[model samples]
Target: MKKLINNFTYITFLGYIAFIPSGPYPISVFGIKLDILLGLVLLVLILPKITQIGKNYPSIFLISLLFYLVTTLLSVIFSEDIVFSTSKWFSMLGYILVSILAPIAIDNYSKIKFSRLFLLVVAVVISFFIIHMALSYGLDKPQRFYLGFDPTAPANYQSDSGVEDIVDPNMTAIGLTLSVIVYLPNFFDSHHTKRRKTLEILAFAIITFGAFLTLSRTAILSFSLSLVLAFTMLSISSKSIQNILTQISKLFCLLLLVMIFLFGIYTLSPSFINGFFARIENIESGKEDRTDLISDTLSIFFSDNKNILFGQGYHITNPHNEFLRNLTSSGIFSLIAFLFFLYTLYFCILKKIKGNYWRYFSALSIYIYIYS
Candidate 1:
């Protein structure tokens, strides 16, 4: 019985990997791959005897979950886009599942294998994706099956960089994150294997370069945060080697920042990136719509309005941001649950792992949570 349960979990893991479409992340998976994680979560739930609750839930994860739950509920309540919010909830649930299973999946000894396979699949998928995109972009043609996002086109970036037909930076960012998480761990290689070490260096470079090409400032920021986290998680033979690694990481970050500035100057030509700057500056003005919507929705929620509390069938809500979206659809209580999920996971890493190699990932997730 134990073997069968374990087999089920592993199969679910494979299914998750196999579901990837032509790339490293889930912009596409937002459609087909959405349900698989939820399914796995449900599977675990069905056999509580097999999946220990304490091992799965941990304490820190439990706290962040509360915030997530509350945020989700509030967002749904105020979201003007109901259908969008419903779809988003699925994503939230998926992240939740990942948080629940990921720590458990790697536990003590498997972090290496899990990290390797994860990195390998991501590197392969994105490399193929970029190759496919490059061909289509170069040809200025799209075959029926070739689905791609080009930021350098008339739609996104046009003036400053002469970059049209570049892929969306966010999509690339998602793929890059997956790739980093997979390869950043030292466990994938052997102590004496020169080839593996070379691959590791090459892998990091490719992922970092690809991220630069995306020309996404926010994405770039996330990558920086993730890298610092990765470095923290890693270990070296001597203080000198560690210093070398640190210097290289700083140089990489500096170059990336320079590239982003140049790209911004080039692509946003029509408005000279000022328009870009203004748009970001405009975000503060939109809070009225958000706050007003939330305030109105709270009336329904507090008055025992079951319809609002349970969620309004998917159109009157979609709080726009992750925090707001959760509260409207799920409720304030659930919003807190979501936050608990995030913080608890952070706490788990800090509390559980005691190693030099884990510094990068440990500090990275916390940084992401901070910015998020």
Candidate 2:
């Protein structure tokens, strides 16, 4: 039984890398309409003894999460659509519960290394998808369902499900950025072999290219922020002024190369530049209505101050932002609990995690979640 659970744990870890749900549409297989990877992760967490793999979490964090869950449950009870609210609540609860067990599933440093390798493999797979999509676009061909490819859009489009094997383009871009970020530090690690460094560089370039093809402004912005934060962390952690200067020089050189490359592309393709800039211009002009949506969310929150305690009861779905979604969906109480839990979790991860990779990953994961 333990062996079976162990196998499932490894499978789930690999699934997270290879099959993260990202498509605008979900692919169904054998009548299963949900994310297979997430499902496997749920199972890993459910199996006896699997949850014991990681260090114990803080009692306060657990208590806060429980409080948040209770608030969510109360919101569901008062929800206009009880059935839908309940379903969504359970789904979110399951994800949160299972994710807490991720470190348990990994269980060791070796497993973490394997997970990074798995991520690299996934990056290679994404490169293929990017290439295929680029070819299709260049040929002016219709989207191929088999490739899980969608045309580039200025913003995230609401879709019922994502395709199999390929994630949504925006999510794909985010994932690619995550891969690049994880490896970025290692690329500069002087202790690594020449061959390894070469591979790391290639991987970074490929994943960055994939992100470029996605054309997702949110992903791009978030990725850029993560890079900045990562460099800041590195600089702060350095022991000497010389180390700081070295890091700064490396960052500057990398940015210069990227800028030069982008400039070259802009000069070479006038139409592409016009189209891309036009999308940015549209965003600047507030054509996306996101600001209006945020305004509406604020109005909803203030219209009934009583709702601040118990929320609007799950019927209001389009918050357009995570903080508003938490506030209006589960009330101010839940939002506070959630924020506290996040703070505790981040603190614990930074203090307890043994490896650099996992530490960076935890920070990046939280940043991605809040932004997403």
Candidate 3:
């Protein structure tokens, strides 16, 4: 039984890694969307071994979530498209619940370590593809030597689902950045070999520079922030500092190599660079600022009667900002509960003497959650 659970863990983690760039669109496999994350979440939550069926949560939270769920049902009842609203509401809730529950279920360091390895493997695979994409297609269209081999977006346009949302150069760049930066916490541990450490840092630089090639203001900003937050979150013991300096030297060497790669990319493909520059012009025009979406979200939030406690059932589920998206979707009660969860996580990792990569992951995960 334990071995089965262990197998389930690896399968779920690998499935998550596979799904990230796999268009998140449901493919009709036996007439169903082959979404592994949703399936695993259901499996874990339902398996009596995964969670205690009658285990108590605070009544206050239960009552609040129940009330909000009812309100969401009301929204669906009043919605112009009942089916859309119902599906969207449940889908959004399921996502929030999974993220919370995944970490909660890891009962020990071994599980956390296993989870980190899963994410790290994903990072390496994504880094290689990002490198290939930069060299061959340069994010103009995201082609490569392997996998879905076409210099076009993976998403099939006919679906009209959000997956069909254009895989813009910046979005591709951001996806690669997620692959690298998510592993930042793994760097500090002495367990990572010198060569492995250098490779990870190199991957981060290439991914970041490739993001620059897309000229995506958000990607650039997010990478810069992810980096800054990483340094801010690091512990500065003398030995740690010395070890980090050693890693930094290797990191710099890796960056130089990527710089050479960038030069080759530019000389070989001016069109990709031109496209990147075009995105820069759009940024200056305030296109990336998302002013319209911001205005709409604020207007809806303020106009609603929901208090901090309940938040009008988080009426605006699809807010442009990720944090705001959650803020207005899960009652403020849920938001705060999650925020407290994040704070406890970050504090445990950043300040607590016993903290390790798991804690650091929790910290950065929260940061990415809010800001990404």
Assess the local accuracy of residue 296 in candidate 1 as a C-alpha lDDT between 0 and 100. Answer: 68
- Per-residue lDDT of candidate 2, residues 93-140 (tens digit): 766756676666557766766676677667767666776766667523
Q: After superposition, how far is residue 314 of candidate 1 from its true place, in Å?
A: 9.2
Model 3's TM-score against the true structure: 0.64
Clashes of each: 75, 8, 2
The residue pairs found clashing in candidate 3 are 306-312, 314-328
RMSD after Cα superposition, model 1: 8.7
Give per-residue CA lDDT, model 1, range 1-372, as digits (tens): 966856565556545553332232332243443335545554464444335546555655665665555556565555556667667666566556665655465354554456455655665566556545544454222221122454234324443533233334455555565555544445333463887677666665555545443433455566656555445444343268767677567557756865676475446343424443443465446753545666666665565655445544333444444555445556555555656665666556656554544444535554562345
Superior by TM-score: candidate 2 or candidate 3: 2
Give the TM-scores of the predictions, in the order they appear: 0.58, 0.81, 0.64
**Worst 10-residue lDDT window, candidate 1:** 138-147
lDDT of each residue in 1-372, candidate 3, tens digit only:
976866576567456554553223244455555664445555565344435322423434444555555655555554445576667777757665555455544446565555555655554465455456556654555232222333354434333443333344445555556655555556666788999888766665555554554455566567656554544444343257776675466446645765676677678676666665566566535645466666666566566555233443434455556556555554454565555555454544455433455445445644654466
In model 3, how large is the Cα lDDT of residue 363? 59
Which has the greatest TM-score?
Answer: 2
